[model samples]
Every structure is written in C-alpha cells, then in structure tokens.
Target: MFALNRKNSTFNFKKADFPKLYDLLSKVDWSEMTNVKEVNAACDFFYNTLECIFEACVPKTSISKISRRSYPVWFDSTIINCLKHKARVLKKFRMYQCQRHLDEFKKLRSQAKFLIAKGYSEYVKSMEDTISHDPRKFWTFIQTKRGKSRIPGTIFVNGEAISDPCIIVNNFADYFKSVYTVSLDNNYSANMTTNNNILLPKISEDDILRQLREL
Candidate 1:
C-alpha cells in the first residue's frame, strides 16, 4: 500500500509562512535549551518542537489509488465541457419543454457525438502510424488497455483451490510439459521426406542456396 503523510512529509511554504515561522522561532526559549546540561537531549527537544510546529501549519494531504490509464490520448477537455453543459441544458429542457432549450440540447448532443467519433478515428490512425515506426510502443498501448487489472488470489486446478505461488507455477509447468512432450517412437521424422512420385515441381537445394545469395 502507498502512504502519503503531507504534514510531516511535505512543507507547502508560502510568503505568509515567513512571518509565522519567525514568530514561532521568536517564541522558543533558546536560553532554556542552552541551560540543559546534556547537549543531545537539548538538541533533540529543539528539533522535535520545530518539526511539530511545521507539521501544524501545513495543509492536510489526501491519498488515493494510483490511477491507471486515467485518460486516453484522444480525450478532449473542450468536448467534455461541452457535454457537461449539454447535460445541464437537457435537465432544464426536461423540466420545462421550451423549444429553444430542446433545440440547443439536440445540437450540442450531435456535435459531441461527431467530435467523439472524429477523435476515435484520429486516435486509431495515430496508433497505426506508431505500429510501423515503433512496434513495442504499439503493443504496450494495447496491453495496457487489455491487461487484467487484478491478479487472481487463488486458482482452481483439478477441482481444488490452490493459492500457493510455487504450486501454481509448477501446475502450469506440468500442464505445458505434458501438452508439448513428443512421443519418441511416433516415426514423425519419416513423414518429412519428399515423395519423388508427386507431380508437383520440386526445387533443388542448390537453387534455393543460389536465390538466397542473390539477396
């Protein structure tokens, strides 16, 4: 879990703070700290008190889950604002069916739809162009959109709930191994030989080698 403690972790200083800081420092009795026979205790108290004062002045901080892909590249703030205005207009129109309000809402709704479609088309075009120049980025964008947001806490294998990480990995390994493992005595290699009786033309190995060299 991510934690943010604004009071202690951050100092949002403003011009107004200079006066407050000065006053705070002035109110502290430096002589009393000096009178403490032990140097470490006096230093600790002085610094701790100063820290507390600073924390008292700063604004409270708020923390939330880190947003993943909060907004797509083609999202237009102008269009969003227009939509919001249209929603308000719609509510007013519904309350009192004035032709002016109804017409305005209809026009705004059509405009929003058109702009949204245009944005989507442009976004797709940009992605296609990016795929040609940088395939890694194109795939990354797709993965971020399609990727699972949460990992399964437990996996069910053979009608049993399995939660151990190592067990889960081993189960997948065993499954894939069984699926791909070839039979040693299947005579699969014999089928790869070319049949001379076939009517189709067969290019010689030398011809293929010569073509590769030409490239």
Candidate 2:
C-alpha cells in the first residue's frame, strides 16, 4: 500500500487584502533596522515585523495529516470525470429511489470500470512497446508507484550493517575512490599535457541562442 502521510500549513494568498498589507508595510519604520549594528539583529527585526504584518492581514490554515493512495499514471481527467459522474448518479439514485436513476447509476458504474481497465491496459502496452528504447520511462513509472525515496536507510560494508549516515557516506567515498583511482605513468602524464595544450573552438552568442531554441 503506497501512501503519502504529511501535514502542511498554507495561507490563502489569493484572499489576502493586498492594499491593506501594502499600507501596513509602508508605514513600518524600516530605518530602525539601520540603527542596529549587527546584521543578524537587523535581519531578525525585519523578519519579525513582516511576520506580524502578514499575520494581521492574512489568515493561516493548517492541513490535517493526509493519507492518500497513489494513483496510476494512466488515471487521466477523462477517468476522473467519469468517476465523478458516477458518484453523482449514485447519490441521485439513493435520494430518489427511482428505477431510472438506479439504471443510470449501474450503466455509469460499468462504464467507469471499463474505462479504468482500458486505460491500464493501454499504459502497460505502451510501456512494453517502449521498454527496449526508453527503459527510463518504465523505471520512472515504477518509482512513482512505489511512492518512496530511493535513498536507503542502512548500508552494509563487509557483512556489517551500518546505519550512521556519515559512516555510510565515507564508505561510499572510499569504494568510489578505489574503483576510479588510476596510476599516473610517465606516458599518461605526457598525453594529458598534450591534450591540455589543445585548444577547442570558441562558442558564440548565436550558437547558444540556437541551442536554447532547439531545446
């Protein structure tokens, strides 16, 4: 079960009174910060004043912990609309208890199921078709479904499990150094000096603009 669990604090910036906020900010004596010699104290005073003004002008809302199931990449807006319509139909059937509403609800329910299955099938087919050429897309989709970071919580070295982040990092550095370290023979050093003496062509502004346009 892949789920996301977190809480966030947000403010409705769209609903804020910009005029009042601007007026309050303009009224603040910013010159007072200049009198403070320490840069940290000046920054603290500025931040506190802005925070107070923001709190007075805008309301803060806290989002409760959200535990949501991960949806597939194939779940598009069409499927969303179908599900919403199905829900509305079900609500109508329950409220009216009419035969017509019940029939409509059943029809929509079947349609929604069919659409979902078809979407998944198409998604799988596309992945299979492109796996040979673009395997990254397939792996990226798998990672999305996993809904967790790729970083591991523990690393093992020489059959001993190490969980300390600093030790794990040092182990990685040592392993990489062992793998990449190269012996500097006299010939290799001479070849490197020769390569360093070779100058490459300079790139112009037009070349950069052309590259940006292609991107």
Candidate 3:
C-alpha cells in the first residue's frame, strides 16, 4: 500500500494512507464509494462468488461438461446480470480505473483454496493459487456436464463454448438419450435467446480481449 509519487518525489496518499486514512475518510460522504468501489468489485465478486456457486450448483461428475459448454453461458449470464448496476458505475469511473485493485480481483480465483473448498483442501488450494495468479493459462470458471454426481469441469485456459451444439449433447444427451434424437441446437438456441442480456452465452468481452492479447 505504498507507492512513490514521482510528481513530488514523495509518497502518494492512495497507497500510503491506510488505517488512519480510512478512519478519517470514514466521516466523509462515502455514498458514492458504494457505486465507485463496485467498479472492479463486480469482477472480483465474479471470481470468488462463482467458486462456491460451481461447487453447489454443479456436481463433481458433470462439471467438465458444464465447464466446457453450459458454464460459459451460465457464468457470463450470472456475472453480467449480477453486476448490471455495477457495470454502469464502472462506465462512469472509466477515467479513474483502479487497475491495481481491479487487477487484484483478477487473482481471487487462484486463491480459492482458502476462499473455496473441496475434499482436498491443501492440494487444490495450491493449484488454485497458481491458476488464479495467471489467467493466460488459467480460467476461473469451469464445470462438467450436468449429471447426478460429479465435478465435471476444472477451470482451464480455454474450453468449448457453453452454447455449442456438440457440447450440449455431450453433456445432456443422456437426459434426451431415450426421448428423441433431436439436435442439441434446439436447447442451445432456446437457452441463448432466453438468457440474452441477463446472462451471457460465453465469457466476458474483456476476458476475450485479454486472451487475444496473450496470443
């Protein structure tokens, strides 16, 4: 929390100010801080919130399918909708993006061992930390196909889109395996249109850009 201010060859308050600074500022009108802090807080929440969500919503067996297909749709849709109001605030604060803080949220997933849980806490924590620190080779959200039991998907650098027809069938085919030979497209199309603005069919536009940058 300390950084040199080149302008004055001195310390800057943003980093230098800590406990006392926060206490003093506590008296000021921080009504806007709620809106302001959420700028990147949404992204941070996405990283952390989704961990528990995946564990609870997705079974261990089906996670892989969800990760490869349905997850992108669910994750993006969940995040975008959950943070719709925050996105607006972020837009307003474009001039003052706290890249450092925003960047920190980007690492929350890697720290999932402590933040999240599984049967194996230690090993998963180590792996999660490593992955969270690096996005190019790590993806925060992941899942397997939906099923009775399973942790289907593990986060990775990349995977199949949630809406892919191939993914749909591979994951959910069993449910319809006996019903019909209908294409997974029917499901994909229906889900996509239904979730539109509320939930995305894939990862965020920003993550795509970051991935592109790495390439």
Candidate 4:
C-alpha cells in the first residue's frame, strides 16, 4: 500500500463581495504607482495593492488530502459502517478477554468479509453488463486495476537503440519538425502573389440590409 499526500488551495468566491471589491478598486489611487521611477518598483506596488484588496475580499483556504492506494473502489456507506463496527468489536475483545466479546468480534469479522466480497462481485457484474454499451468505462476500470504506466527506458531511433534521454527527446522533436514543416516552391509563391492581386467586390449598406432581409 502507498499513500500520496497533496495540498490544494481555493478561494471562497461564493462568500466574496464582488461589488464592494469593484468599488474599492475604482477608488484606488493608481497615481501612487506613477510616483515610482523604476518599472520594477511600479509593478511591485501595483501587485501588492491588488493582493491586499483580494485578500480582504476573497479569503483563501488550504486543505491537505491523503490518498491510499489500498482503498477499495466498491466501498459504500454500508460496507464502511460494517467495517467500523467490526473494528470496535475487535477493540472490545482485545481490552476485555471475554468469550462473548471474542465471539462477537469473530462474527462481525466474517460479516464484514462477506459484505466486501458481495460488493465487489456486484460492481464487477455491473461493469460486465455495461461493457458492450460503454467500452471506455470498462477500459478505464481495467487501467485503474493495472495502475500507472511508466515511460520506456530506451527508444529506437533510425534502427539504433538509444538510451540517452536528451537524444531521444531531440529525435522526437526533429521528427515532428520534419512532419509539420511546409515546403515552399516558386509555383506556390506565384500563386500566392496572384491571389493577393485579386480585388474583392465592394458592398454598400443597402446591399447588406437587402441580404439580411433575404435571410
């Protein structure tokens, strides 16, 4: 099992007073920035002022999330509550070595296991039933089971195996450049010049109104 930790930040825009922010911005003395002689100083003042205004209007919040790879996808409220109950039973059994507590723990453990298996089987059956109509979903489930894909350590270029990352990237860039490069010839250039020389017909307001009426 692996755990991945990430931090996400978002602004509370729903609670923000955008009208007040606009009024505040409109009242700001932007001429204060003009007093700064250096371009960097002026930019710093401008950014700082706006940052203070935004901080007051729309506060930001940071949340930390931890994801576990061992967590099952078929987990639901019923399964979760059963598992929690089983854990509590096991804890009571451990604290008090009573035969009744031990038996209860064992029973709950078996029930939890059964519920997990049943949930997993039902999820698989649903996927199987929808496979013909939604193959993409089936394939996505397959991919999740297979886990993340890794880039190849070596690549073939011009019938030669290359292991250097820089060389492989350069080869890809060169190949794409060749594929997308446009070739210019005398004939193409002459055609472009002739097309540029062709004049478009002029249309008056009356003609535009007539076309709109027809539409």
Candidate 5:
C-alpha cells in the first residue's frame, strides 16, 4: 500500500531478473548473513519484478567497514539505476548525532531560524538535549578536521553537527503485494522491529513474510 519505489525500475545488466540475479549473488557465500541475504534477495527480486518501482542507490553505513573497503565501486550503485532520470521523491535525508551536539544544534536553530521556517531549507535537527558540553569529545577517533571522507564540515542540527548522515526513504514499487515500512522520524523512536504498527507502513505481518517467501 505504501507506494515508495515506482520510478526508474529497470536495469541493463545481462541478467536483469531478480531470481536469476540472486542466483549469481549466491556464489559469494557471504558469511553469517543468510537471513539478511534472504531479505536482500527477496527485496532484489521485488525490485526487478516491479516494473514500476523507483529506488535509489546510496552509500552504506560507515559501520560496515569491510563492505566499504572491499566494494568501493558499489557505493552508489543500486539493484536498478535510474538511467531514465525519473523524478525521485525522497524524504529529506537526516542524521542523528550524539547528545553533545544538541546545544550546538540549538544554536544553529537560532542561527537558521529564518531558513528553518522555509520548506526548501532542509535544516538538520538534533534528537536529544542531554550530552556533554564538548561535542567533539564524544566522538573519540572521528574528528571534524582529521580528513574523514564522508562528513565534509559541521552542519548543526538544533545547534550541533552530527558526526554522520543517515536518512529515511519512501518509494512505491508495483510488484510488492504487501507493505513494509521505514521510519523517517525520531532516531530514538523505537527499535526498528517494534510491536506497534502506526509508525511503520500499513501491512499485515503475514503478508509481509509471504512477499519475502516469494523471493
């Protein structure tokens, strides 16, 4: 029911079908990720099958150090790249930082109050008020000026610039019969696999698994 991936759906690879594509990926034997892989495989299949699905390729979390180092080439590549340049409807990307950044983010809020009021400003905000006064002290090794690749400069949310960028995505795909949700709100809202339904997309849990089984 949640229409999140509906544009830029096709791929130009030799084997574009998800089932076939997954078979090729199975050769890699990625360790201890059977369950995760199953999900990814099913999702891949859904993307391939859904001719109307629109999705974007984005950078994986920096936490996945091995994958980042190993597959530098695959960073921005997706199962389906939008060669057609379809209009992408993305919920503005966000990042949730440590508590130390809250005051700074608040300062930024004051600084950006006028801009924050605008729809086009895309202001970043902190998730909490409780943290150490020294924002940089919170992040031990990752420093603002130590030449980190991803984070270019400090952008205050509330008043602090979070150490990293994370985001929430919504798109519609046609072949997906059931719904799965991704949250675009408070970082501390709840664990991703929560018991409640409202924060997530509308879909029966059984239907969700059934769609997975399809892959």
Candidate 6:
C-alpha cells in the first residue's frame, strides 16, 4: 500500500484570524484574470494565499491519535449532568446511609428515565411524517434508533460452524440464493398449465374491478 505523502495541516478558526483573512481577500484583483487558465491560476492563488494567511494567524496543532467514547444520540450534556448527579447522590447515600440521599437518587433516576424515554419517543415520532414521502429515509431513521444489530459471531454452514466474516457472508448469500432461486425442469415447465386443480384463494372479479374503478 502507498502511504500518504501529504502533510497533516490542521488549523482551528479563531476570532483573531478574521481581520487577517479579510485583509488577504481584499487585496485580490479579479479583473486581471481574463482567460480560463488565468482564472484557474488566480483561484488557486487565492485559496493558497488564504490558507497561508489562516495558518499565520491561527495556531496549528499536530494530529494525534485520541480515544473517544461513543454515546447514544439522545445523550446530551443535560443527561450527562443528570447521571453525574445521580452517581453523586448514590455515593453519598452509601457513605452516610442517609434516606434523603437515597430518595434523591431515586427521583433523579426516574427523571433521567423519563427524559430518555421521551427523547426516544420524540425521535421516533419525528420520522412518522417522512414514512409516506421518503420510506428509505424513514426506515434508515428507524434502524438508527434501533442501533446496531447483534448478529451471532458464529454461524453454521453445511453442518459446520464458521465465524470468519467472509465465510459467514458467503454462507448467508448462498442460503438466500438457494431459498429464492426457482429451479426449472423442461418437461414440468412445458406441462405447466396441465395441473388443473391448483389451490388458490377465491375472490370476486367484479369486486376487484369495482375497487379498481373507485381508485
């Protein structure tokens, strides 16, 4: 694999960079670039100059690997604070054996639960209106709310257990293919309509026609 040759150049926009950026942009002469090539060069120059000015004005930090914890979408600062308060209450209750601390913890816990449930309900309700117009988006929203699926790490294939991702994927693909595929035999296909006594649900054609006409 070819390693990236590009340097990691990252800068955060600060209030101090505003005047420098404005000054850099104000010096541009757009009228001089008459041809496409000149225009392209001018555009590149403007972008590069802007970047230089931004780099000079703002402090750049070296990219470092950082560990982050992923939380649910409904988890905001309010929920975090609520959880922290509950934890503190629990700790105090345990330390002092105080009934009030326990009661406070229970109250906070109930409030947090209600808030989480309400958040999820609102989240789901928000998608209801989109179901008719954008079903794909609606289902995507539902799946996101449901979070990740917990498929078993190991699956049986041809009487043997397999856990490798590629093998499991291929096994599932093969199973689905076999289940959905229709096998055809020339003799049976040629005499397809010969079976006169096939069980099918009886329905009134006139009723169907009436419904269609109404539609």
Give the candidate number with the greatest lDDT: 2
For each candidate, what TM-score against the reference? 0.46, 0.40, 0.14, 0.43, 0.13, 0.47
Candidate 2 lDDT, tens digit per residue, 43-116?
Answer: 88887887778778877677776535445789888987788788898898899998998998899889999999
Model 2, residue pairs in steric clash:
none
Pairs in clash, predicted candidate 6? none
Error of 3 at 61 (Å): 38
Instruction: Write down the worst ten-residue block by lDDT for model 5.
Output: 83-92
Which stretches of candidate 6 lie above 4 Å from their native place?
1-70, 131-152, 181-215
Cα deviation of 120, candidate 6, in Å:
2.0
Q: How many backbone clashes does candidate 1 have?
A: 0
Q: 50-90 in candidate 1: lDDT tens per residue?
A: 77667665543344545453555566887677777898999
Error of 4 at 156 (Å): 15
For candidate 6, the 10 contiguous residues with the lowest summed lDDT are 1-10
- What would the TM-score be for candidate 5 when compared with the true structure? 0.13
lDDT at position 118, candidate 1: 90
lDDT of candidate 6 over 96-207, digit per residue (tens) = 9999999999999999998878877776666565555566756577456667434457888668889888888887888898899576878666566776555668779666
lDDT of 5 at 19: 62
Can you tell me which runs of candidate 3 are displaced by over 4 Å? 1-96, 113-146, 149-215
lDDT of each: 0.70, 0.79, 0.44, 0.76, 0.37, 0.70
Specify the poorest-scoring 10-residue window by lDDT in model 1. Answer: 1-10
RMSD of each: 11.1, 13.7, 27.0, 18.1, 28.0, 12.2
**How would you encode candidate 3's per-residue C-alpha lDDT over 1-215 as one tens digit per residue?**
22222332432233443554445445544354456456676554444443333333333321122232232322334343334434444554565677754544444433432333332354334545556356432343222223322323432225744554456556666556767765678878788778765454778867966664554
Top-down TM-score ranking: 6, 1, 4, 2, 3, 5
Going through the candidates in the order shown, the clash numbers are 0, 0, 31, 0, 18, 0
Candidate 2 residue runs with Cα over 4 Å from true position: 1-26, 29-70, 142-215
